[model samples]
Target chain A: MSQPAIETHDLTKRYGKARGITDINLTVNRGEIFGFIGPNGAGKSTTIRTLLGLISKTSGSATVLGYDITNERKEMLAHVGYLPSEVFYYDGMRAKDLLKYAASFYDGDFTQRIQDLAARLDLDLSKRIDDMSLGNKKKVGIIQGLLHSPDLIILDEPTSGLDPLAQRTFFDLIREENERGATVLFSSHILSEVQNICDRVAIIRDGRIIETQSIAELRRTAVKRVSVTAAGEVPLNLATLGLPAGSFAGAETEGPQTSFVFNGDCNVLLSALAARRLADVNITEPSLEEIFMHYYQDGADRGGAAHDSAAQDGAQR
Target chain B: MNVYLFEFRRQWRSFLAGTLTQAIVAAVFLGGMYPMYHDSQKDVEKVLAGFPPRFAAAFGITKDMFSFGGFFAFIYVYLAIVAAIFGALWGLKVFGREKLDRCMDFLISKPASRMGLFWQKALVVLTGIVVMNGVFLGVALWVRTSVGATSPGVGQFVLMALAVGGVQLIFAALGALIAVLAPRLHSVTGLGVGLGILGFVLSALPPMTNESNFKAISPFSYFNVSQMQTQGTYETGYLVTAGALCVVALAVACVAYVRSDVKA
Candidate 1:
């Protein structure tokens, strides 16, 4: 079998007393659009930096494209393209010049690729880097990262500074790159971006991988946000509705309407609500943030540890 | 190698302008003084002799004040100060500019190793100093030979230039070391100017303190112009110390730079 595109085993990095990342074990298969989802300061960037060897790992080990990240950093980096959260380049260089310099490091002809990306992104190649706006600079970063046609593309909050139109184009470009057999590891706090593209996602919290699942599996686990507008005044107490204990989170009620996130069996919830007077009801998938909160609501008791063994098996399969 | 070429090209224009400015200033300022001193040799010597002993020593004045070599040595003391500061600033920018500008991510994420990048930057620093000193030496030589002024012979002037070059090199390495050791340094140029002025002041301290071992601490004293002129060569012991310091500092800089946790 082919080796995974990227893999880490118990990677940890501690900056004196502060925790950078702790015991992060991850596996991204070849040709997969893997999402690394976490909020700010959640160790997403820390983990990616360690894999790219931008910072040394304090313990454990990792490999990218079959090369040990710590020992064979140069060789590993040859096939990896990284776009950091904040992009900085030589201020005096023109956009084209910077792209050319980036291309010079990899042994290939990237002229056509660069030109295509620049034209599609509407980037002004002649402009000096210092003069470009943040969005334009991000475009330059995207071009430089993809110009080498790397095997693994790692993006850390890659779309933060892009306009909506540009973002659509960038996503299209990523899909095309993936179609061309490039594996992508995208890190972002935004949910829709991950939902739209990622095949699998690993949700991180406070430097630990709390959950890893295929997008379908993750969506299945996410509870529904149910809203009910009763024909008559409903009881203010939601616990008397007869759903599983603690299944209702952040339950709140108005004079005739009620809403709460439901995490238990749908049949039990339907039976509990059937006895109410005729009313309007709406059920939808909970927001990613709400789902994330559920996982974090009860630390370690919410099967985060149980999911670890399942995730390991899932990784192997 | 690509990074090296890119950095060289990016900096060459400014480097050329600054070095030429230094070279022209040195040639015009020092070369212009030679004829004035020579024509009024008697008056210059009488005026110099009447100055207090402390002032004379402060300015590195001795009995050979009327000769071409002595005047050349005297003028070089001031020139070395400017060159050393310029070299220090050059060295500080070698690694500091990347960190200051937040360009570490771009370089560090590339296929190159950290050691490779450090060495490339170190090479650029060394080359910058060499090129700057080369211009200074070239212009000084041209002014002396072309104008046919009352100046030291080619051999003595070359020796003096080499000594000044040594001082510049030592400080340049020191600056590079600081760049690696203090990755978050805010004012590299300010530090360079400060060190240069401090060295200049300390160079005068040894004379006032009766040739104490304290002189060994400053690069400015490594190439004592008075001793170079009278003895016809740089002090072998001090020269060795300067060379050793340059090597050790540069090596430490490379190791520190490679081991540093680059903050993107």
Candidate 2:
């Protein structure tokens, strides 16, 4: 079997005892669009920087395209293209000059590729980088990253400064690269974009991977919004419902309607509801945000710790 | 190689123009005053002879101030001060270019290693200094010949210019060291100018204190203008010390850069 395009085994990085990332074990299959989803300050950039060998890992090991991130960093980088969250270049350089310089470091000439990407993205090659707007700068970044036709592309909040139209064009270019057999690792705090493109996602929180699974599996099995209207005043307290804390939340009481989100097995939730005399009940899959929130607030809330660990099991299932 | 060439091309026109213009102007103005000073040489010498030795040394005024070569050497000390500032500013800009511009991510993410990046930047700084010195040498020789101060031989002129160049290198290395050690480097040019002034002040102290050890610590004292005019050589001990300081500063800068976190 071929090696995975990207893999990490117990990878950890710390900033003088402060959390950077911890015990991260992950795998990105060849030719798949993998998502690394997390909010700001959640170690997403740390992991990406470590993978690129821009920063050293404190412990554990990782590789890109079968080359070790430490000893073989330059070789690994030869095949990887990265776009950081904030795009900045030498201020005096024109867009064309900067792109040409970027392309010179790699193996092949990228003149035609630069022209094609620049024309498609509506970037003016003649404009100085310092004089361009933020959106235009981002467009230049996209062109430089794709100009070399790297085998692996890594983007950190790639669409942050782009307008709606520019973002759409950027996504189309990414899709084209995917079709050309380039594996992508797309990172973003925004769930919608990941949902739109990723084959699988790894949700991170507090410097740890809390869950990893396909979007389909996450929606179908792990979390569901449930509403139960008992025949009489139902058990309003979650502890009395015989379900674990975080397994259910947002329980509200209204006239003949009591509802909460259920985040565990559908069978257990249905059986629990069967014990109560009910006028009606409904079970539905929740959105990705709700599922992500379950992991984000894992230990912060006194009642959600159980659900965070249970969500890990759901990911495995 | 591409990065070095790009930086070199970007800086060449403005840097060479500004430095060459300043050197030419200084050479012309200073060279023009020599004929006037020589015409009244005996009167000026009698008046200067009455001042205390310490006061004369403080102003870089020597007993041989009546000679053309002596006057030129005195003016060269002031030129060294300006060259020191120029070198420091160039060093800070080239060494801290990525951090100052907030482009560390763009540069470091490329295929080059950090060590390779450091050497490339150092080459640019060194090249800028060399070009500036080259222009200064041409202007100095032309001004001396045009103004009829042909007493100093070609070898002596070369040695004096080389000593000034040595002082510039020392300050440039100091600037690189400071750029690496400071986290923010908020105003690199300001820091460079401040340090250059400080080094000049320290160099001026030995005359007042009557201590040769004070001369050992400051690069300004490394090449004595009076000694260069008379003996036609820089002090061997100070030259070695300057070379040692340059090596140590550059080495520490490389180590600091390789270990630093490329913060966004």
- Name the top TM-score candidate: 2
Give the 10-residue window scoring lowest on summed lDDT in candidate 1 chain B: B144-153
Measured against the native two-chain assembly using Cα atoms, what DockQ does each of the candidate structures obtain, in the order listed? 0.67, 0.70
lDDT, candidate 1, B44-80, per-residue tens: 8899889888778777776776566777677666777
Which segments of candidate 1 are over 4 A away from where they belong?
A: A222-232, A241-246, A252-257, A264-287, A297-317, B144-156, B185-187
Per-chain TM-score, chain A, candidate 1? 0.89
Model 1 chain A: lowest-lDDT 10 consecutive positions: A308-317
Tell me the tens digit of each residue's lDDT in model 1 across A1-317. 88999888889999999999878889999999999997899899999988988788999889899999988899888899988899998767899898998998899899999999999999989999999999999999999888888899999999989999999999999999999999999999888899889999888877878778888777677378888887867633577777776677766787777878778789888888887764688888776666766666644455556445544554344
Which CAPRI category fits model 2?
medium
lDDT of 2 at A205: 80
lDDT of 2 at B230: 88
